[model samples]
Target: MKKAVFLDRDGVINEVLSSRVKFVNKPSQFYLLEGVGEAISLLNLAHIPTFIVTNQGGVGLGFMKESALHNVHKKMIAELAKYGAHIEDIAYCPHKPTAGCVCRKPEAQMLIDLASAHNIDLSGSIMVGDREPDIEAGKKAGCKTVLIGDESDNFAQANIVFPHLLAAVPWILEELH
Candidate 1:
């Protein structure tokens, strides 16, 4: 089976939106965090399939429509293309926390679904992201978890934590080999 890398959107991929970048409802709002494109390209060059696991509750919460999210993703893909990186698959949970959807991060269902659908060997895969939930999902899915930020000095779910996605590359490459 093949291994994959799952990435989170929002603060992990781009700066967390605020009044200035307020929700990424359009292509213009889609910006890449420093080293994101290069990091993704590095994973691509290493022959790792990359996937995006995002919690787009904005749609369910009425912050934006689904079409807007699609547009932003399309733009995001085009931008990544310029750097020779591409996401193999994308999955999102549009439900809010109150809705308790299965696909939400920290639940592991998204990873499980993707693993099954993509024929991934969960044990060999790594889930890299910035939030606790992202790491938790990886743990629950039985993959190696790498937290892409030292925001919280104490993250119990992740086996490892680094300052950014770029820092996690060599480990991911090693894990695949």
Candidate 2:
């Protein structure tokens, strides 16, 4: 089985905007955080198939339509391509927190599905994100976890903490080297 490095969209690969007020209802609101492309490129070079698994509850909340989310992802992919990096797959859970959907982060269905579909070895895989649910999901999926942000009460479960993706890249590579 192959290993993968699962990533979160918002905050991990891109900037996180709650969009609670204005709501990122359109593609124009999506922005890539600096250095994300190079960071992902390193993962690719390391022979790790990188997958993006995110919780896009904005669609279920009526803040944005599903199409908008698709468009944003398309834009994200295009941007990444410009830097010569590509993501292997992208998955998302559109249900809001109240819906208690199983596919959302903190649950491992998405990871499990990907592993089953692609023959990924979950034990060697790692999940990197900027939030608590992302870490939980990785753990539940039996993956190593990395939290890219501050390490307060918000990310107690992460195996390693980094300030950003670039900082995390070396450590990820070292794991294999």
Candidate 3:
């Protein structure tokens, strides 16, 4: 099996919006975070397989249609491609937090399912995120977790913490070596 990197989408790859909707419901609302393209480009150049695993509850909650999510992903991919970055796959749980879905963050089902489908070695993989649930899911998936954001009680569960995803790239590459 090959090692890979899994990333959380909202805050890690794109700017987390502070609006009434609070989610990227449309392509226009999706903006890549600073240095995100460069960071993912670095990983791509290293031939590392990268994936995005996110919890997009807005879809299930009827806030946005699935087609809107696809459009947003298309925008994100197009922007990243300009920097030579490529994502192997993108997976999301479109269920509300209270839906008890097994694919949600804090549950390793998404990662595990992706790992199985792609032949990834979860133990050798790294998961990077900006939220506590992200770290928890990575830990549960047996991946080395990196938290990108302010310190929190659950953030302590990560293998390491960084101010942002760009800052964590070097360490992630180092571990892969």
Candidate 4:
């Protein structure tokens, strides 16, 4: 079994827009948050497989086309590549929150599927996210959870918490060793 890191996309990887326009609808709307490149690059250098598990309900709501999301990912990938970072795979839930899809956060389906596909050891993996649902999913999947933002409500649930992804990197690397 292999260990891995799972990251939530929105607030963890890039800036989350205001409530009115919450999704990155186009490539231009996507921007890697500060330290994201260096953080991911370090993970790459360590040979840790990293993946993105996100909820993109905007697709189901028709806020943006799937193609647009692809473009946004392309932009993100290019940006990360500039720092020698790479992502192993990406899994997302396109269903609306009201749809209650199994792939959505708070459900372990996406993590389970990825773990199965990648032969990962869930107990040895880490799931990093900015919200409570992300922590819930990690718990369901039996992985250690790291919260990237100050969500007081989630502090008890997360195995660890940090102000940002870059700040969490050292601890994450320590855990792997």
Candidate 5:
């Protein structure tokens, strides 16, 4: 079975504009964090497929159209490609948080679906994100979890914690060996 790395989109792959709002509603608002492209390139070099699993509740809440979200993703993908990095696939939950959708973070439906579709070994895979729900989803899918962001008691459930995605990649690669 192949091993993969699952990543959360917003805070994990891009800079989160918390000062403006929690969600990125437009392509202009989407910006890749420093070193993200390089980290992904390293993962690609290591032959580990990367997948993005995110909850875009902004669509369900009417904050943005699905087309706008697609545009944003296109921009992100293109930018990563410039760095010789590529994401295998992106799975997103476009429902409201209250919609009770199984595909959202903390539910593991998306990860499970991806695992089935790609023949991935969940036990050897890792999920990296900046939120509690991300860790929960990874755990539910039987993946080791890496939490990114400030250290806090809230992230105690994560198998590993780091300040950013770039820092987590080396640890993940080491763990895989």
Candidate 6:
């Protein structure tokens, strides 16, 4: 079975505006966090497939249109490609947090679906994110979890916690070895 890495989009892949408590709703607002491209490039060189699994509640809340989100993702992918990094696929739940959707983070539906479609070995896989929901989903899906951020509260659930995505890559590489 193939090994894969699942990443949360907002804080994990891009800079998060803490004051707003929301996602980058426009391409103009989207900015790749430092070292993220290089980190993803390292994973690509190691032949590990990476996928983005995110909860896009902004859509359901009418904060932004789905087309706007797609535009942001397009720009993100294009930017990553410039660094020779690639994302295998992106799975997002466009439902409100209160919608009780099966595909949101903290629920393993999206990861399970991706694993089934891609023939992934969850035991050997990893999920990296900056929130507890990300870790929760990873655990539910039987994948190791890496929490990226300095939040004290979010640290308890992750198998490994790092300051950022780049900092977490070495540990993942070591585990693969």
Task: Give a tens-digit lDDT track for model 5, residues 1-177.
Answer: 998999999988997866654568988888888889999999999999899999999999999999999999999999899899999999999999899989998999999999999999998999998899999999999999999887683454899888988898899899776
lDDT of 6 by residue, 1-177 (tens): 999999999998988876544568999888888899999999999999899999999999999999999999999999899899999999999999899989998999999999999999998999998888999999999999999976585754788789989999999988765
State each candidate's clash count: 0, 0, 0, 0, 0, 0
| TM-score-better candidate, 5 vs 6 | 5
lDDT of 2 by residue, 16-58 (tens): 6554323445777777778999998888888889999999888
User: Could you tell me how far off, in angstroms, the CA of residue 175 lies in candidate 6 after the best superposition?
Assistant: 1.4
Candidate 3, 91-126: lDDT as tens digits: 999998899989999999989999999999999999
Give the CA lDDT, 0 to 100, for residue 44 in model 5. Answer: 95
Query: How would you encode candidate 1's per-residue C-alpha lDDT over 73-93 as one tens digit per residue?
Result: 898888788889899888889
How big is the positional error of residue 174 in model 2, measured in Å on the Cα after superposition?
2.1
lDDT of each: 0.84, 0.85, 0.91, 0.90, 0.91, 0.90
User: Which is superior by TM-score, 1 or 2?
Assistant: 1
What ranges in model 1 sit over 4 Å off? Answer: 151-153
Instruction: Estimate the TM-score for candidate 2.
Output: 0.93
Q: Of models 2 and 6, which has the larger TM-score? A: 6
Question: In model 1, where is the ten-residue run with the lowest total lDDT?
Answer: 148-157
lDDT of 3: 0.91
Per-residue alpha-carbon lDDT of candidate 4 for residues 111-173, written as tens digits (9 for 90 to 100) = 999999999999999999998899999999999999987757575379998998999999999
Off by over 4 Å in 4: 18-21, 151-156
Point out the worst 10-residue segment of candidate 4 by lDDT. 14-23
The lDDT, on a scale of 0 to 1, for candidate 6 is 0.90
Compute the lDDT of residue 149 as modeled in candidate 6. 77
RMSD of 3: 1.6
**Cα lDDT, model 4, residue 70:** 87
lDDT for 152 (candidate 2): 84
Our model 5 lands, by Cα RMSD against the true structure, at: 1.4
